[model samples]
Structure formats: C-alpha cells, structure tokens
Target: MKKLIIASVIALFILTGCNKDKDILNTLNDYNISQQDKGYHFGDKLNIPQDVLDYAEAISISFGDKETSSLSIDPKFFSLGENDVTFNIKTKSGEVLQQDATINVFAKAKARPIAYEIANQYPHDTNSFTEGFELHGDTVLESVGLDGKSKILKYTLGSRTPILEVPQPSNIFSEGITLLNDKVYQLTYKAKKGFIYDSNFKLIKEFKYPDVIAEGWGMTNDGKNLIVSDGSKNIYFLNPENPSQIVRTIAVASNTEAYDQINELEYHNGSIYANVWQKPIVLQINPANGEVTGILDFSNIAKQNTTNEDDVLNGIAFKGDNMLITGKNWSKIYEVILK
Candidate 1:
C-alpha cells in the first residue's frame, strides 16, 4: 500500500509539471506585445519586453520582411514613413512560434536644403492679400484675404485686372481655395464654413468645414483628395465627395523637430510644397509621411518684395514647368524653375 501511494504521488508530480509547461506554451502563443507609445523615434533604443525575452529562445526584429536591427532607425528606414516592426520568436528547439508582435516606427525630422533658381517673374496685384494661388493654363486664380476685402479673383498671367471676381460675405474672412474636378472649393478663416463654386466662379453651395483644425490657412488638391492646412503642424486630407470628413492627417516635421504655421499649400510633381507662415522658406514635403524632403529658401524673393512687415511671403502656384510665387500686398509674382 505504501509503495502504491508513493507511485501515485510521483505520477501526480509529473502530471503537474506537464500542465505547467502546457500553460506556459499557451501564454506564449496568446501573447501580443506592442510599443507603449505606438511609435518610436529615430535613434531611440529599441525596447524588448522582459516577459517576451523570458519565453523565447531567440528573437529577431524586422521592418516588413527585412531585418532592421542593424539599421537602428536610420534614414533608409525613416524615409519609408511609418513602418511596422515585427518581433519573431523561436522556441528552445528553434521552432518558429505561432504568435508574433509588431510595433510602429515614426521618423524624426531631418532638414535638407533644396536649391532653386529664379526662372522668371510676372506681374501680380498689389491690393490682393494673396492667401491662395493656383494656375489654370496661362491664367491664375487667387483668394484674397482680410475680413472686409475677402474675394476670389481670376486674372490673366501678367495683368492686375481680374477676368472674373466673386466676393465673399463681408463678415466671413476667407482663407484658401482649391480646384477639384469642375468645382472650386474655398475655406474660411474662423467661420468653419467652406464655399463651393462652379467653374464660372458662381457660388453653388456652402458646407461646414471639419472642426479638427482651429483655423483654415491653405488648401490644394492632389488630383484625388483635397489637402488643407490650419496654421498648425498638421495637414489634413479630405475626400472631395465628403469635404467635412478627414481621410487622414500628417504631422509636418523636419529632421530635428516638428514645424508649425504651415500655410499656402501647393501640390506639384507628387510633392506638397507649403509656405511656413512668417518664414522665408518653402517646404517640399512628402505627402505619404509629412517629411520635409527639401527647403526652398525664398529669402531673396521676400527681401526684394517686402513693402511692410505685414506683407509676408504667402502664395505659391504651379504654371507648366515653372512655379509662380507672390505675397500679400506686394508687387510682382515670381515664375521660377526649381533646380
């Protein structure tokens, strides 16, 4: 009887050990670890959870399918925008586990000085407090700002006289304008309303803009969607069919830091170019990641065109292969080929 009892006790111990091992395996299989902040900056030390380390015999980190541990959040990884880092686990026998973990990687701002040459200059209206500018063939469309003076005007390339003019409500302060399909969409500064007009510059509808932005500053369309800035670091993409709905938001950043006061946007050659408010630099930004790929210094243009401190550089438009830029209450419009 004593021998049988001891044998039974030994069998119970073995069964308990097996159950413990099975529980560990079950926990490992179900474990899903993520970065605490949902994003890691460039050069930030990669953090591996202690629990994850204790369970796995070998661990490998990868961006997409390629191992990124060696890159260490370098430029190559950052330039690709947000990335998913997968943690692959292996068991004691080098058997791949069923469960894997993923973390998000974000880029740290990096500055790149872009070069440009003045290809030509054109005549622009001095009375126009240019907030939005766009080119349709040889003609130019502009949205002039200020509470009492707000209006949308279409002008011939070198003429101060407008071909067509549409006035906004005297109380509504107008901001940016963009052309989508056969319609014109315009933003207001603080009213949280946007105006839509036909190709002939006649008001067809007025819709409420999204409240995600504090104030409207600039707007442009990328063939499919409308991109808007609100005098902040954020740029929002909106569906044309549903103007109030935001498709996504991109936070503008340089190599070392994030930037604010992004205004007067223009989409050209697959890049979003914006004027940083009150600054003499135009940022060539990547739409996918909000990375400032290049900085076009407009100090020369600003210095040559400044009538007063209020007349800051503001307008940007694409005309064929050249870019047309102007400012608030300033004289000439510059047509330059970015080199």
Candidate 2:
C-alpha cells in the first residue's frame, strides 16, 4: 500500500511539472509579435506583453549566436528583414524557457519612387534568354541561360553582334556575370559552380558556390568583393579570389517588409540595383545594410517588351551615365535616365 501511494504521488508531480511548462509556453506564444503586418523598424522597441512580464524574471534575445539583454531594435542589435531570434526567459519558477520566433525588421524610411525616361534604344538578340548584364567601357557584357544554350558574350553598345562570345558546356545552365580586376566571373544555375576568365576571355579556373547558396541568380562587383544573389531576400558578398567564401550576408528589406527574388545585380554609385523577378520593378538597395532606398517602376517598359509570361524584364546594365535594361528573349534594349 505504501509503494502504491508513493508511485501515485510521483506520477502526479511529473504531470504537474509538464503542465507548468505548457502553461508558460502558452502565455509566451499568445503574444505573437511577428504577426504585426507593419513590423518593427530601427529605433523601435518590442513591447513585452503583460503575461510574459508577470511570468519571467529575466529576458534575453539571441540572433545568430549573438545575445542581448535589451529588446531595442537598433541596427546594432538587429538587421533589416526577418530576424530569427530566440527568447531565453528565466521564469519566476526558476525554469528557463526558450522560444524561437521570427522578428521582422523593416527599413527606417519608405523607398522613394523614382520615374524613368527612355533615352535611347538598341537592338538585342531575340534568341538570348538574358540573365545577367553589365557594361564596361563601350562594351556590353551579357550572360544568357538554358541547359544546352548557356553562354556569355560581349558586344559593342550600339551593335547586335557579339565581339566575343564564350559558350558554356552543353549541360551547364549559366546565370549572372560580373567583372572585377579585369577578370570575368560567371555563375551557373543549379550546377553550383562558377567560372572565372582572364581579361581576354580565356578560361582561368572554376570554383563552387558555398554550401549555403543553392543556386546563383545574379552577380556584380563593388570594385572589391563580389555581390551575389540567389533568388532570395539575401545578398551575399563573397571574396573575389575565393568565390566559395562568404564575407557577409544582408537581407533586403524596405519600410513595409522584406523582399525576395532579387536578380540581375548591378553596383553603381554606392547603390546596388536589383531586379525583382517577373515584376517590372527595379530596387535601389543600400549595400551597407540592405535597406531599399529607391524603387523604379518599369511597368510601361515591361508592357512594351512582354509578349508572354516568360518575357519578364531581367537585365540591368549601366552605359556611361545612363542605365540600359532588357528582358528574356527581348528584341530591343532601352536606355533610360533615372529621375
């Protein structure tokens, strides 16, 4: 009878402990800060809920192995876009409760809407499924994609024929291209490899993408590091000497929320201009923290070129002081001046 009584009491204690933890979790889960459509921004404070306040003795936040006791959304404490954070709560019961959640941080200012005026037009290859584009001196460098037809080419600004064209292997689907230190860098889609070339377009070497990036979408350079996008909200800065090494990562976001499908990158005048896939819009992002500073709506230009769904605007290049844009299988390229 005594053994039976002891077993009953022990079972009751275990049940009570489980219920306590569940109740505390329920209280913490009830306050969902991430659900707020207009998320927090720089200089904002995450309001602690009354229930959490009552239940916790100490609260701490952790992001990417960095932990802080304060909940301020300072740029030093948090980054733009989605922040996956862990709340380490020391409860009044001397129990530690860890809650993992997403805290979205937006840009401080709304993205300025910029308009464009067509400056000139040039002929482009309708057969080119244009992926990456940029201009160096009087030459326009382009990278086109497809399983059997991926190639990189460079042509004069006003001409349709390429002065230099290099085709990829038949099975390789190439994506973006960039130039740094007079060497050409090109990324491959899904193949997880990148090709480097000498100034004269001779194959120098090949390297693989880091384990974190699954696919390469666009690439450009800031005179030093190579800035790459993987069709996500992230922009990865990599070492030009070693493409597999990640220098840093920034998540692109505006005042309202974070954005994805960042493609066709171009670094010019301290801003990284990017194309949002399938949308006739170009975003000017501040590379310092991935805060979107300006937006250029190219809906009319897209309408002029878009014949079917796949003919979305997907190219960005700078010609002298003006910007040049084209699309997949586009017959014409338009030069524009940003206002």
Candidate 3:
C-alpha cells in the first residue's frame, strides 16, 4: 500500500510541473499587448491587458532627451507648443521604448526677422473684399466677398487689370476660388451654392452645398480633390465629384486661444498656404495631415500702411513657382519668395 501511494504522488508532481511550464510558454507566446517600439498619433489610443496595466504604475514620455512622466491636457491634442516632438516611453519595469512622432500644437506667430523681399506689389479695386486668389501662367483668378457684391475676376498678373469678371447670383456672398484644369470653382458664404466658371470667366455649372456647416470661408485644391475651410479652425478635404463626402478634416493650430479664421488658401509644392481672415499672417502647412510646419508673418505689410487702416491680409496666389500675395483694399500685390 505504501509503494502504490508513492507512485501516485510522483505522477501528480510531474503533471503539475508540465502544466506550469505550459502556462509560462503561453505567456511568452502572447505578446500582442507588449510595448510598442514607437508611440502613436494624438488621436490614437492603445489598449493594454489588465495584467500589463497592473504591472505598470505610470508611464514616462520623453521628447528627445527631456523626460516628461506626467502630462495632461483639457482635451489632449498631444502638442507642446510650436516645436516638432518625438518621444519614447518608460515603464515600471525599467524598460524603455521609443516613439515615432512629431508633436503638433497651435504655434504662436513669433516675430521672426523678415526674410523675403517685397519683389513687387499690384493693385485691386477698393470696393472688392478679396478673399482668395490664384495664378495660372500670367493670369490671376480672384474671389471677392460680401453678399450681393461678391464676384470672381480673372486679371492679368502685375497689371491687376481685370480681364473677365463673373458676378455671384444676386444676393449670395462669394468667398474663395480655385482653378482646376480649365474651370474656375468659386464658393459662396451662406447660399449653399458653388459656381464653376470656364477659363474665360463665363458661368459654366453651379453646384449646391448641404447645410452640414454654418459658413463657407476659404478653399484650394491639391490636384486631386478640393480642400475647403470653414470660418472655424477646421479644414475639410472633399471629393470633387461629391462635395458632401469628407475625406479628412483637421483643426488648425493658432498661437492664441482665438480661432484663426482661415480665409484664403494656396497649395504650393506639397504644402498648403493659408491666410488668416482679418489678420496679417500666412501659414505654410502640411496637408498630408493638418500640421502647421512654418509661419510667414507679413505684419510688415500691415505696418507699412498702418495709416490707411484698410490693409487686411486676404489673398495668396502662386505664379509658376513664385508666390504672389495681396491684401484687401491695398493698392499693391506682393511677389514673395518663400525661403
């Protein structure tokens, strides 16, 4: 009887040992929730297993060499001001992990030494509340604002003389305009109508917009689709064929708490350039996702004609490879060289 008992005990011990080995192997194999080599975007959320979460007391995030263990935000946008940020993560286990990132925040317009020269300035009518402008070859296309007074004009570069002008439907306020192929597309403020004009500035086709948003402010194109801006901080990418469908939307970054009312837009190289409504500043932004990479403070232009008080920055046009910018009621169109 003793010998039989001994054999049974020995078998039970071996079975328990095997089961423990299997559990350890399973833990080793289940690595789906393990630490990622890089951190994700601001909007990305990561889920950790309960066991991993319990093991982690806190996480340390580092940008470059500076370590920030506890960071907080009202509505977290993952930005630490104007600088591009890359980070790494540290855990309770003393293991460090790297994050592939660039921090994006509302960048304040700092007073950088003006780098570009005022190549030239052109003139527009004093009554035209110009909102957007673009250049194709030597021809300049413009959108003038205000209800019952808005229109799209095609002008000769340098001369500022209008070659063709197409007025918006009687009572609708016109806003931004852009050119794709041979057609000039124009947006209206609240009438929900967008007009397409031929190269000759003749009315070709009209499209209607749904009341998805309150106001139409600015617009540009990326050679593929139309990009529009509402007066708020948000910018929307839309399908050219279907205006209602949104491809993507991004909240613009402003240095101040005030929302930068984006008024005009121009796509140059791979970046999107925008004019702040009623302000004398332009931003060079990344369009892949909405990241404000650089800033061009044309406050000098605002200061130049401080006596007039009518010079508000409003227009941006790219001529060939050069950029031509203008202001409302200002007599000069500026040729700017982006450094």
Candidate 4:
C-alpha cells in the first residue's frame, strides 16, 4: 500500500507539470497580438497592450531584431520616414512563438492655425513666371520657369526692371532659387540637375538632384541648411556642402489631412512658409516636425490678380516686418504682416 501511494504521488506531480506547460502554450496561442497600424510621431512612447504585458514574464519582446524588455517602446528605433517595425514574441526558453505583429511609424507633428494680414503692396513684373522669390538685402532674387523662358533675375523691391538676368539653357526649366552665403543655388524641374551660381549670376557648378525626390519644386535656407520641396508632401533638408545628400525629410500635413504639391518655400522667423501648388493658401510649417501651423489665405489676391488660369500664387519673400507674395504673370507684389 505504501509503494502504491508513493507511485500515485509521483504520477500526480508529472501530470501537474505537463498541465502547466500546456497552459502556457495555450495562453500564448490564444493571446490576440496584432500589428499597430496607427501613426505615431517622433518622441512618442508606444503603449503596449495589457494582455501582452500580462504574459511578459513568459515571453520576450522585440522591435525587428532588436530585443527589448517588457517596458514601453522607444521611438528612437524608427527612422525619420515611413517605418515598418516588426514586433516579435518569444518564449522565455528562447523559442519563437509569434512574429507577425508590426507597427507603422511616421515622423510627423500635430499642427495648429496661424494668422496674417495685408500690410502693404509693391510692384512686380507681369511676365515673370515666379517659381522662386527671396529678398537678399534690398534686392529680390527671382527664378522664372517654363521650358524656353526659364531664367534668374535680380530686381529691387519697388522696381519692375531686372537689374540682372541670367537665362537658363533652353532645355532646362528652372524651378527654385536660394542664396546661401555669396552663392546662389537653382533647381531644375525634371532634368534632375541643379546649378550653383555666384551672387552675380555666374554658373559655378552643376549637381544632380538626390534620388529620393521625384522633382524639384521649391527651395529655401534657414541660415544653415538648404530646405527643398518636391511637389509631394515631403520637404527635404539638404546639406549645403553636398547638395545631393539629404540630411532629413519632413512630411507636411495639416490637422485634418496631408498637404501635397508643396511648392515655393521660404524660411522666416523660425518657421517655413510654403505655397501650395495651384492653391491660393500659403501654409506656415514648423520645420522640426512638418506641421502646418498656419494658413495664409491668398484666395482674394488670387481672384483679384487672375488674368488667366495658368497664373497661380507662387512667390514668398520676407522684407523687414512684411511678407512679399506674388504669382505667375503677376503685375504687383503684395506686402502683408502676420497678426
């Protein structure tokens, strides 16, 4: 009887061990681990599901191949652009269990509205297809576009006549112009090429556009780096030393939707002012996170200046306390102060 009792106790112990293992496997199988499809900006901490936390002791967590503890996810693991991070769960014994879960990450920021007013007005050339406009000292440097009509012109604030003009090659359609130090950088439309010229309109060198951008649409500088825009929702920060290398990318968006066709750019007072292509509204963007914090309504100006359908508001420049804005074939440059 004593032997039989000992044997029965041993059998019970074995059965309990097997049940525990089975329970652990069943718990892992039944857990609903799904990929997070929502967008998260940089500096945001990801919230792990409570269910996953409950089983944290039995499994390991990781983003892609980088192993992580049961603690919250760190956003630093992701890149500046769109990212797909694979999340995996493994047994404490180092056996893989689930690896299908993923998280979609976006480097974006929340946006708020900014306001402005029409402070003043100035004269501009009606024939200038203004693609790029900037005020260097008291001179307005403009880049005009169109296959056969592309050129760079330098004019005074109140003058309609260009003090200097440099015509582009007949095949190259100039898009945007930016002056950094004593050099002027000009981008082409679809040629995938750019020009480096002196402030006096002498061509110094030519560079190919970075492969990341589809085409050049706008360009600006923040006293440090060159900020560029392709007609897409993205804005690229390029290294001045190497214009083809992209330093970073920001996806522009409003509170409700992403803003694409982001044309002519100007960096002023710690913000990026962008003219949306074919749209009369200028978006005030936070360069750090690509958020459209303000919308400058140019609809009235567009309607008042419209001589043809091809003419759209496309120029932005800062002079003293006012902003200079104009369009293709525009006869006047409107000066406005932001409230």
**Which one is best on TM-score?**
2
Quote the positional error of residue 30 for candidate 2 in Å.
Answer: 4.6
Task: Compute the lDDT of residue 174 as modeled in candidate 2.
Answer: 87
lDDT of 1 by residue, 1-339 (tens): 999999999999879755644555455444424342445566765555456567668766666546653525555544323344555566565655533443334445556787778888778888899999999888788999999999999989988899999888899887899999989999999998888899888888888878877888999999999999999878999988888999988877665445778999999999999998988889999999787888889998899888676799999999887888899988999888878
- In candidate 2, position 131 carries an lDDT of 91
Task: Give the winner by lDDT.
Answer: 2
- In model 4, which residue pairs have backbone atoms overlapping below 3 Å? 114-294, 119-336
Q: Candidate 3 clashing pairs?
A: 39-99, 85-103, 121-333, 122-332, 122-333
Clashes of 2: 0
Model 4 ranges off by over 4 Å: 1-110, 307-309
Arranged by TM-score, best first: 2, 4, 1, 3
For all predictions, the C-alpha RMSD in Å is: 10.1, 2.9, 13.1, 8.1
What TM-score against the true fold does each predicted structure earn?
0.71, 0.88, 0.66, 0.72
Candidate structures ordered by lDDT, highest first: 2, 1, 4, 3
Q: After superposition, how far is residue 286 of candidate 1 from its true place, in Å?
A: 0.6
Better of 1 and 3 by TM-score: 1
Model 2 TM-score on a 0 to 1 scale: 0.88
- Candidate 3, 116-159: lDDT as tens digits: 66666666676667777888888888888876787888878767
How far is 185's C-alpha from truth in model 4 (Å)? 0.6
- What tens digits encode model 2's per-residue C-alpha lDDT throughout 1-339? 999999999999889977876776776666655355667888888877777778789999998869999978878878788778888989877889998877888888889998889999999999999998999888989999999999999999889898999888998998999999989999999999999998778999999999999799999999989999999889999999999999998889999868888999999999999999989999999999899999999999899989888889999989776889999998999999987
Error of 1 at 126 (Å): 0.8
